[model samples]
Target: MIDETIEEIREMQTHSSSVVAVKATRALAELTERDYATVEEFERDLERNVGALKRANPSHASLYNALQDVLHSVQGEADDLDEARELTVATIDRVVETVETGKRRAAQQAAATIEDGQTFLTHDYSSTVMEAVELAVADGAELTAYVTEARPRFLGRKFARELAAIDAVEPHLMVDGATGMFLPKCDRVIIGMDCIVEETLYNRIGTFPLVAAANEVGVPVTVVGSGAKVVDDGFRFENEIRSPSEVMLEPVEGIELENPAYDATPVDLIDEVITDEGVLEY
Candidate 1:
């Protein structure tokens, strides 16, 4: 079961970084149910599984931090196998709760930033962004959202479909390359973050260009996600190179198809970051 979860995360079948972390933490909690002979054995197994999950998606700081929090809470603190298992489960529960609550609060804060009749241009599929849009609409804020066709996966199509269902939001599907063309039509560029390492924000591959275009047009960019995405520790972002088949089913003989999953955008291009804590001005 844990292996399946790890594979789901690694294959990018999971929806978002927040969902991935929640799924991972729940998987770790389930691991405690298995029988173990000794505390040492339990510790080793826990470490192994945590390492595997972290490696599954190294770009997700939330997952890394969640696993590390569980390990630290359980490691050397339990006197027996039962105690270790208990500690691990408890820690996983706390981490999952914190992650979910943070996401909810952050989404609410992001929604609050949306003014009535504001036009927003967004990239890719962000659960937080989706929730924010829903909340804003529910609160009677009419909005227009331009969604990019985040390529190789076309996640933005999914986002656009969801936004279309909202009566108050006018959703427009835009090609990824046409961001510059659409920037003049937008009042703001609001998106989601995978993680922020220092001064750089890493998000879906097309984010850099979208942000660059938004900056050029003087459109304010707002990134919304849990503060957990801000990696302050030793966690580093690892770019995933997907199968060329994802870009094109038929491989070109001499053409090298590079499908990078994410790209780094300098924080300077972003005007604000909305998290559970509050709005952070860049």
Candidate 2:
């Protein structure tokens, strides 16, 4: 049953929105309530399940932090399996509440950076980024958004549509390759991160180049995410490489297709990171 749950989580991580993936992963903590003979057995099973989830979506620091929070909370707290199970369930509740609250706080903090008559460039779709922009619009800021058509999945198109729905935002969709042409016209580049390792930001595959272009044009780049996305310094991190089928389905002989789902943006290129706590200057 645990194996099936992990498989379901793996699929969700690949296909669902990040918020959905995170909430679904938190639900897995309930597995602790199942029958177990001893606390040691429960711990072992929980660790294994969490490990599987980590391997399935290594780039998601928020998911890792949530599981780690629960794991640490239940450690050595109970002598019996039933007590351990209760403790794990309670910890999961706290983690979920903290995650939800943190996201809202981060969104508000990021929105503070937006101003009227400013043009912002963004790549890919991020719930945090969208929420921040929406909040800024609500505050009566007139803004323009230049959205890249992030290829393979075209998530940027979805972001553009969302922005177009806002009366305060003028949304323009451009090809991913044309970011350099558009960067000079934008006041700032605002994007969302999947994780932050040390000072490096990991995000959708095109983000690094987007940062590079913004930097070259003297435009500041801002990253918006919850503090939970920051991973410990020594944590081993790996990028997720997606299937070539996502780019092309046709079979070609003797041709290799590389589909990297994410890339890292060095700290030097980032102007600031806005999180639940506050703004962090890089």
Candidate 3:
């Protein structure tokens, strides 16, 4: 059952964005409800399952961190299966609550940075970024958003649709390659991060080039995400390589296709990272 749950998580992470940590925490909670003869058995199985999940998606540090919180929650308190189960559920609640609260706080901080009549450029689809923009519009900032049609998935199109639905903002969908052409006219760049390792922000594959273009044009770039996405020093975060079929459906003779799902952006290109705690200047 634990193995099956881990497989579900793997499938979910492949198609979803930024919700892997919350899903993993809930999966662990489900494990705790199952019947276990001994506490040792439960711990052993939990560790093995979490190890499998970590192997499945190494780019997301939040999964490992959330599972670790669950494991530590019952370290000395679980004398029986019921105690262990309760502790696991409690940990899941705390982790989810903390993540949601942090996102809300980060969104508010990000929104505060927006100015009236400014044109903001964004890439890919990020719930945190959307929330921040929504809050800024609510605050009476009449803004224009230049959204990239992030390729392979076109998640940015979805983001553009959401932004267009808002009455206070105007949204324009542009091809990813047009970033260089548009950056010079934009006031600022707002993006979302998948993980923060040291001084680098890992996000959608096109983000690095977008940041470079923004930098070349002297446009300030801000990243909005939860503090939980930050990784410890010396921890390595792998970039997930997606299937080439996502980029091309037909077979090409002797031609190779590369489809990297994410890319890394150095801190020098970023002006600020807004988190629940506050705005972190880079």
Candidate 4:
């Protein structure tokens, strides 16, 4: 089960990074259930598995942080293997709870920034941004959302469908290239990030250009996510290169095809990052 979850995360089968972190952390808890001859043996296995999980998706700071919390707890001095195992399980539960709670609070902060009768341009699929829109609407704010196609995956289709379910949001679906064409009509550009490492926002492939266009049009850009995504030093961000088949079912004879899973957007282009703590002015 642990190996399966790791593969799911590496393959991007999990939609949200927060969900990825939770699932990865819970998978490590499975390790605690196994029989170990000594506390040292259990700690050894834990470290090995933690390294593998982090390698599955290095761009996921939440996953890295969650696993780090568990590893740190288990590595502490314990009376016996049983004590170490119990501590590991407890740490996993605490980390998962924190990730979920932080996400909800961040969404609330983002929603508070939404004013009634405002239009937003969002790229890709972001559960944080989606929840913010829903919360704002529930509070009686009418909103309009323009979502991009987010090509190679069409994640935006999922975003648009969810927005359409809300009674007060007007959802518009457009190709990724049409961002500039519609930016003039948008009041803000709201999105989510995989991680913020070294002050750079790593997100969906088209996010950099979208944010750049939004900045050019003088529209404020807000990134909504948990603070766990703000990675400190020692964690590296690696963008996954997907299969070319995702971009084209049948490749042209001589043309080279490249499919990058994410892109880095400079922090200067963003107006603020709203997390569980509050809005962070960059």
Write down the RMSD of all candidates, one decimal each. Answer: 0.9, 2.2, 1.9, 1.1
List ranges where model 2 is wrong by over 4 Å: 1-21
Angstrom error of the Cα, residue 229, model 4: value is 1.0
| Per-residue lDDT over 150-240 for candidate 4, one digit per residue giving the tens place of the 0 to 100 score | 9989999999999999889999999999999999999999999899997799999999999998888899999999998997687888888
State TM-scores per candidate.
0.98, 0.92, 0.93, 0.97
Error of 2 at 71 (Å): 1.1
lDDT to native, each model: 0.91, 0.81, 0.82, 0.91
In candidate 2, what are the lDDT values of residues 230-249, reduced to their tens digit? 77664666787877888889
Error of 2 at 138 (Å): 1.1
- Model 3, span 1-282: residue lDDT tens: 456656765554433334776777677766776677898888887777677767767777777677677767766778888878787778889987877787788889899988889999999888888998899989899999999999988889999999989999999999999999988889999998888998888898899999998888899999988888877663478877877788899869998999888898898789988988888888
Where is model 2 poorest over a 10-residue stretch in terms of lDDT? 12-21
Better of 1 and 2 by TM-score: 1
- Cand. 3 TM to true fold: 0.93
Clashing pairs in 2: none
Order of candidates by TM-score, top first?
1, 4, 3, 2
Better of 3 and 4 by TM-score: 4
The candidate 3 region of ten consecutive residues with least summed lDDT is: 9-18
- Model 1 scores a TM of 0.98
- Alpha-carbon shift of residue 62 in model 1 (angstroms): 0.9
Give candidate 3 misplaced runs (Cα > 4 Å). Answer: 1-17
